[model samples]
Target: MPGRLKLYHNPQSRAVTAHWMLEEAGADYDLVPVEFREDGTRDPKILAVNPMGKVPTLVLEDGTVVTEVPAILAWVADAYPEKNLAPAPGSPERGSYYRWLFFVGSCFEPALIERMMRQDAEPLPKMMVGWSSYDDVIDTVEGALKGREFLVGDHCTAADVYMGAGLWWGGMFKGPRILESEIIQGYIARLAERPAFQRAMGG
Candidate 1:
């Protein structure tokens, strides 16, 4: 087993997703809070390990630094297999698991940012962008959740932690068509009911 992990987190940031994953995996870890400066600079301690100065930066016992949210969730799930947070290695379910995890960063995030942050700007050509458009992204997610209780297989996986967090955060900010979609709202409610999610939320 690996030694205790270190997670630099900030409640106001996406680090909350990693924190939730840690609780779900029941991993032995330390939460090192990184507070930002008024001028938007980060502490040297965080910059030393991850010059990107991003929260949710995880350092393993061997000092391997894992940045990015999906990578962290994937690592923790595989590290603690007994938790059943992931599917069997070669199963189709595992393939679906990886898909949704990657989808969040690849499709959902950029599309969301373009939609929310660039409302006054011209819509980027669908053929020119990776996510195509925010409407397409939302439609894809809604289609995925049509008859599914979770993103992959019957039980919740690390993908749920990432996806659910994104949706929940989006809805909180009133992301277009997110809160209005019954399917998305239902999925968020289910994930919010999880004990791990609740604990991460400081409930």
Candidate 2:
């Protein structure tokens, strides 16, 4: 039997990604909605559960708390391997799966933030930059996604869970067709069609 799963969520936050992941993993869980207070503060009650006061925090039956979007998705998938949302550790595809997941959090996110803040004009050492540049990161991801349905292969894995969410958010800042590349747009479209994603999106 699986453990009880509790998901703290605020639809407008990163919790949306975990909601899709929970549906994809087919995990038995409950979504506790959090609302911002009228006084311009987050719900103090949730702050007790997550000191960082962030949404999308996962609480396991064993009372363990998991934060961070990628970590939460990775844990939920690993906890329910029967879903096969990820390549098991030690497999060749696992390397690519992990690579894509981390790259979104480490590389793509920073670049998007930098671009949105309009700070890219400042001279900075490319080597010192983590995500390098938005253009470079987009090119790298587009090249990798060209012939593959998913980041790892033809199968939908946990990496797609994160990457797809990233693309959706990127579209908000970069416009509706940020990933209009033939392959990437199609790939994201396919992922969007999944019953799980649609279901999580309140289909």
lDDT (10s digit) by residue, model 2, range 169-199: 7876663237566666787788899999888
Candidate 1 C-alpha lDDT tens digits along 86-176: 9999999999999999999999989988888999999999999988989999999999999999999888899999999999988888899
Candidate 1 TM-score, C-alpha based: 0.97
Q: Where does candidate 1 stray beyond 4 Å? A: none
- Best by the TM-score measure: 1
Q: Against the true structure, whose lDDT is highest?
A: 1
RMSD (CA, angstroms), candidate 1 = 1.0
**Which segments of model 2 are wrong by more than 4 Å?**
37-40, 119-124, 175-179
lDDT of each: 0.92, 0.84
